[model samples]
Target: MAYPIIFLLFLSLPFSSAKLNLDYYKATCPDFENIVKENVFIKQTAVSATAPGLLRLFFNDCITDGCDASILIASSAYNRHPERDANPNLSLSGDAFDIISKIKNNLELVCPGVVSCSDIVAQATRDLVKMVGGPYYKVRLGRKDSKVSDAKRVDVNLPTTKMTMDQIIEKFTAKKFTIREMVALNGAHTIGFTHCKEFSDRIYPKVDVTMHPKLAAGLRRVCQNYTVDTSMVAFNDMSSPNTFDNAYYKNILKGLGLMTSDYLLSVDPRTRPIVEEYAKDQQAFFVDFAKAMEKVSVLGVKTGNKGEVRNRCDQFNNNIPE
Candidate 1:
């Protein structure tokens, strides 16, 4: 299948949210939201990691190329490498991927090809947030899956734990996100775990001065041998790792943020106030996060013939006659 690389134009343009609708799948699949809700509940309850994994997967997909499901595409004979194979995306929660697959499979049984994987990502994300004690918001649907899924796209564009706060901000800004919005989106740290390797530098060789002594000592004890067992992990918010709330900002304010990108939210003057405000009020954080997630979900979105509704979330529908 012939494909075009996603252009820098996606970054350059102001995102248009006009095409998506709050009830996009209503007529086509009236049971859409319920389907996603059922699967997310089942997956999340059975696998404690499901909510965070799914949330991270949704974040990775949207940040890279709108909220299209290109991130879910597997490397195949037609395309030897896809976004999930990229180093930055390699840590995307398997439970997240599994839940999306579960939802897609269920949707097919009820509604056939009517629902797109991209929309599933958006809807599932919204449902999961509310399920995890975050504010609920309507996610506009009708986002079509992208035709392309190159590993190169993921390599060059995704944010990393190692990136400076300014660099991360630049990336989000290109997606039309304000610094306040970036801080709120990252409040997602309220639920997930990150591997020790992502923050080992702050604890090893020499302690990073920015970290609180207590936090540093704790991290060093847990991750001292991360080089040998790379699977060692730490929660982003030790206070309530399973809940989506303002505790992540509270942790950052106390110098307990798990990664450089996280720790700098309090140190960066432009973002500190937002972090402080959120830490003071969980409802405020929830409100801002809902708005931020809604905004980011539609950036550079593809609709109509710009993309297709894939039959399989894990591969393109190109082999079938278009």
Candidate 2:
């Protein structure tokens, strides 16, 4: 009886010794939409009512270190944004800053010191999916930030709009993603818009009139006629531009993709089959997309007190004194 009692006590001790506290990720996500509704930036843009920029940052960081949450800061001011001399608003944007602030405030109100900024970014990313007419992604909490920030690192890690199939595969593969994962994740393009400066060369120097003629025409109209030369073009595959379904895959099938990286997914033998299947089934696209995104979010990440919870997502804890 003494032996049995001792064994039972040992088992109970482990459970009792463990600590469990809930935060925003552990609980249901707070009312993010209401928070967005309260944002001044979201109200300013004619089309910025949605906060996909946050989602973009989330995916961008998730590719490596399992969503380290460190992806939010400028690797170096050099790699930060405005990759070009011409585009001043390039690297960082007030829009993302505003959205991340709301996330921090809401989480603080509910969980106080418990929530991780990295986890908040991940959760905010998932929520942004629904905001822009896409599927919801499951977010794991407790990601930590890294003190290291290198512009060169980001330049190497991030995929450019100009990437070819091989280049994309190499980038994604480095991040533990497969060709199939690459195409599905690109479905995120379904709602976001890009500046003509990003893709004008694809249209002007070598126009593939055979494919996406109307889209090409639209691009030409804005890239050429508009003074901003920076006209907004719809992403996604084509048929269901706003919906986050498999229509992107179907667009590939019809040869109507907008970006080089996008078209390469279907044209490349390595990823073609997956694209075709997704084109056929929307449910399959959503399932695969969710899994791939989860894989992307957990790259080189730290969790739990490994770093400070940022008051602002754009920069690290200023109070900590760089």
For every model shown, the clashing-pair count is: 0, 18
Clashes of 1: 0
TM-scores, each model vs. reference: 0.92, 0.75
Off by over 4 Å in 2: 1-51, 64-66, 74-94, 109-111, 131-133, 225-239, 318-322
Cα lDDT tens digits for candidate 1, 256-305: 99899887788889999999999898888888888888787887789888
Model 1 weakest 10-residue run by lDDT: 2-11
Candidate 2, residues 50-143, lDDT tens digits: the string is 4455656666565533465555564334334321111222433446656666667766675565556666666666666665556776655556
Model 1, residue pairs in steric clash: none
* Model 1 spans with C-alpha error above 4 angstroms: 1-16, 319-322
TM-score of model 2 relative to the true fold? 0.75
Quote the positional error of residue 220 for candidate 2 in Å.
Answer: 0.5
